[model samples]
Target chain A: MKYDCDACGPELGAYLLGESSDETRREVDAHLAACTACRDELERERALRTALGDLPTATCPGAVTARILAVVDAEYAATRRRNRRLRGVGLAGGLLAATLAAVLFLRPGAALRGASAEHYTPEQVATARHELIQTLTLTARVLDQAGRSTLVDVFNDQLPSAVEGSLRPLDDPTRGG
Target chain B: MTNETFHELLATHRDRVFTQALFSLRERRDAEDVTQEAFLRLWRQGDHLPADRVAPWLAHVTRNLCIDQTRRRSAARRHLGVADADAVDGLVAAAGGPDDPFAGLDLDDRQRRLLDALQTLPAETRTVMLMHYGDGTKLADIADAMGKSLAAVKVQVHRARQRLRLVLGTADGVSEQRGSA
Candidate 1:
């Protein structure tokens, strides 16, 4: 190839390391054969490398290796933990879905209307409608146990208030009577 | 290789690895951390590593880690506040004539002094020099690592060396050489 213009000086270090491509190595060899300056440069470089090697190395402490091993172990453990959690979530979700399916199919009539309708005043019907809408709204947003727990707590705290408010207006709209 | 063999190899090459890391990081603790991280990564990828390429592989990994560390540090609060004198010197000394034993000098003091003279070169040239001599990285690898062009790396190498010679001349109380890069 175009040996004269193509650069080999950049590959000199790799050449010394014997990591250069065969073609580049050949060019370097030929160049060294003819170029005394490049040859001298290579010698100084080699000597300098030896000297650099001779320069003192930092003393790694006893804990360094231990610390590294510990980190690797910890990472491995964490990955396993995450996988197990995901699997547990999947299993729980499957069981919940199956339970819901059984409830719907095994006893559809009763399960669908456990709190059956009975006689009620307009205020009671209004309260029931408000409670039903509120419960449905809460259940619709409950995506997880944690969120469902919070939703249940919100309904528990609000149903009584909502029911009271719904009938209070029918009984007496006045703030104080 | 088995763990024992790997550890033995590491123990054998620890000095070089640590030295390279130290020079790259310029901090003792950082060097140790990088060394361990590099080896740990090596171990994690051990199955893929061919045995013959271990030392150079370690060097290459350590060098890349150092470069990454430097880049990361350069971004955040300076993890290594220490200026990189080694990178400058690596390229400075990486390509001397193969026959000349460091400018034909037998004295270690003169050699050390000459190297120290590299400090005065322009910062960019010094970096190129360090990659060559300090890390023994090929010019192309140096260019790749430093994100510089081959021509740029060559010019930097040539200029850095020429400047280093002049600086050494000045350091040795001699006149600046009238030579070109």
Candidate 2:
């Protein structure tokens, strides 16, 4: 709709603010071309807007930037540390899960005393038992060095003498070697 | 965002945010506080906020915070029964330094008159004017932040313009009459 001066009077604000729709702007432009009063009002609005825009901007103080950066860096570092700790825990959990699977699948009667034993050749059973015993021996030595002997005691009762000899150093507190 | 990108954002947009808050609040300390708070908010959001939109986002947030601060201040003034003149004094005290809007302006008589007249506008009206004229924020954005209709924000700006014009025009006409006499 082509807004005349009367209709465009209130709409002048929206037009000057660039908030008016294209149709309304076109109408206002057409009206402004003919209406001196409206043109003068528009001029004043433009002048005021220009002056306000030209007003000097306030600068952010150096101190504030320093302060904000410090806080942001600290928070970012904390997030990184937490993520690293989570990754460590995930690695440890995966290793523990692998150890549990080895123990459950290769126990003395678990694979050798049933119809399941026929599925394996004699050579395969011998290799599997040998690897399982080696893994348990390494685990016992690690626990002994760490001074956590509760699980080591259980391993000592079940392991063969060949594996048990390697664990004797872990029981001697004065033996650094 | 990485620290490098955030530092760039701070350098590019801090003045814009500070200017908006300063003009809207008319108090240097409050404006500084608002600017710091807005940037702190930016830091909290971190890489989640897109880089290109940072300027307008900061402007919008700073304006809203200034408006809220203004409302709280006005409420306190009302509860304390502070008069208009005293509020002006409080403004000076709150300013406390070289945060004058007219600073470094080579203003003519009419421009000076307009600036003086601006100081007389009500807080909400002046805020609309500042956001629209000073900060160059869109009226639709101002309307959204002020929680007013677009029409209402426009009307407020228009009225502010008319008020400044009346004050400045009358002064000009009187001076011309004296000159002619």
Candidate 3:
């Protein structure tokens, strides 16, 4: 187990740093025992480590920390502002959809009752159908603008089923009379 | 991350990041700039990084920013036709000034020589030494943070020691003996 200076020289740093494995340490230890030069080099490495450890720690200046935090704060503020705007758009879309639902189903003599009552004319039925389509289109556009266009997919699926019977009189002009 | 949590992270790791940048760049202004930039990046990506990995992530980013700063400086020197002397010379010249981080420290002859010699090593080598010695980071962790193999990190450490010894004029006898053989 004769380790030459060339092989042992590189291990000395890892040895001094305590990063060498057990077998490598044993090998380096054997070389250091027989080799005075390698031992001296190891001592120098140890001294170098000591000197490095003794060097003063550098502190980050206050101004730098302040600048970093300020930038982060500004970014956070921007994100919050964007979120608030989107939320406002979402609220508007929700109100529009709710109103559309109430007008078609809740008003006295509304389209739902008028479909069975035989009191409304064909012109009135056509007008209600056109207004419903326009309101639905506008609500879809508003939701899409708010980046919640997926909600429009839900609206598309549910609204047509609920309103189809009320608007069925459009297919038979005489049914409205 | 919340503002308070981000501030906590800055308080915890600022000095280490700044110290590493100083070791790699050898200029207090550049180090400060790099540190600020590194923390800003951490603030942006903190959500994706695990709490355990935050320190290593910061170390990796700081090291990269320092290397980039060093290269830009070198390129500027080359473009200006200015001879790039050892980086330590600049520190030594500004040692007692207001902006020098090491201004008020009491460094002895050997320590001073070692500090100067350290700046002459490549940025990556110097970074490995600083992480291992200055911050007491493990070699395996250093390898992980730097995205390098453990063997490569060990080799850099060894090269740093050899170069420092050579610069300090303490390796002449053994080096000569080995050179002949």
Candidate 4:
């Protein structure tokens, strides 16, 4: 191994640390035998590594860790509160949606009577129609205010179509208004 | 991640993270700040991080935060027209606090020289040296954690060792001998 100091300098650290490959270690070993400078350099590196290992560990202050945990605890609490609020809102929305569905679908003479408009006078039909519209408007507003757009969408698109389908026979010209 | 798991991670890694930050930034306050920020980030992203990779992930984050703080300090120094000499003096002064790991320690002359030289190296090189030697982290693990190749990590550690030797006067005779040869 004709390794000069310049050529062997880089390998010495790895060689000292035993990070060098077996073949590289042999080459460095052979080089060190012939190279006094390289051996001294290796010794210096060994000393540095030993000093580094001796360097005291710096522990985080108890107060600092406490402060960090305090922040994390506060954050976790706030998140839990937020999740609770959202769950409450979701439950309220679900109940409101179910109530609306029952009012629209389950009331007698509401959806079961195919010709509901024909069964009542013009005034009765107008009053019933106004009430249905008011109920839908209120439900939509509540869902919208709750920031539950999916429920609002159900009210806006599907619920209206359902009401219209139930009253579809009312659109017949042969049936009096 | 559960709160209990996060707390366990903090308990396990806080010292290592704090030590790394202290070494890289050379300031207790900045190191604490970086350590807190790193942990906060870990907490926020804990669910997304794999359990096996937490150590490396935390190490990488702590190193990045330290680097960011170092750059900010350099920019502030440049803005204020503070010379590097004054900044070095500030670092020395900062290390005199009660919590300083080196304070009142019975370090030998060579160890003292090496410590001083460690501060002179670049942040990346210093970090590699400290991680490899101080933390007893394997070079291959450091390479994987730092997203660097094994060869690159070895080079950084080698360069740091060489720089420390030069700073400590151990390399002077060797250099002269080689020069004459």
Top-DockQ candidate index: 2
Give the TM-score, chain B only, in order for the candidates.
0.53, 0.60, 0.77, 0.75
Interface RMSD of each: 7.5, 6.3, 6.5, 6.1
True contacts kept of each: 0.26, 0.50, 0.53, 0.48
Per-residue CA lDDT of model 2 for B42-138, tens digit only, reads 8788777666556656766776687788888879778767687487777778889445653543556655554567668875676667667877778
Off by over 4 Å in 2: A5-20, A90-177, B71-116, B120-125, B141-152, B166-169, B172-181
**How high is the CA lDDT of each candidate model?**
0.57, 0.67, 0.73, 0.71
lDDT score, candidate 2, position A42: 73
**What C-alpha root-mean-square deviation, in Å, does candidate 3 show against the real structure?**
8.9
Q: What is candidate 3's local distance difference test score?
A: 0.73
Which ten contiguous residues of candidate 1 chain A have the minimum total lDDT? A139-148
Model 1 regions more than 4 Å off:
A1-8, A18-30, A67-72, A101-177, B1-17, B24-181
Model 2 pairs whose backbones collide: B1-B47
- What C-alpha lDDT, on a 0 to 100 scale, does residue A86 get in candidate 4? 67
Preferred candidate (TM-score higher): 1 or 2: 2
Top lDDT hit? 3
Which 10-residue window in model 2 chain B sums to the lowest lDDT?
B172-181
* Candidates 2 and 3 compared by DockQ, better number: 2
Better of 1 and 4 by lDDT: 4
Model 3 residue A88 CA deviation in Å: 5.0
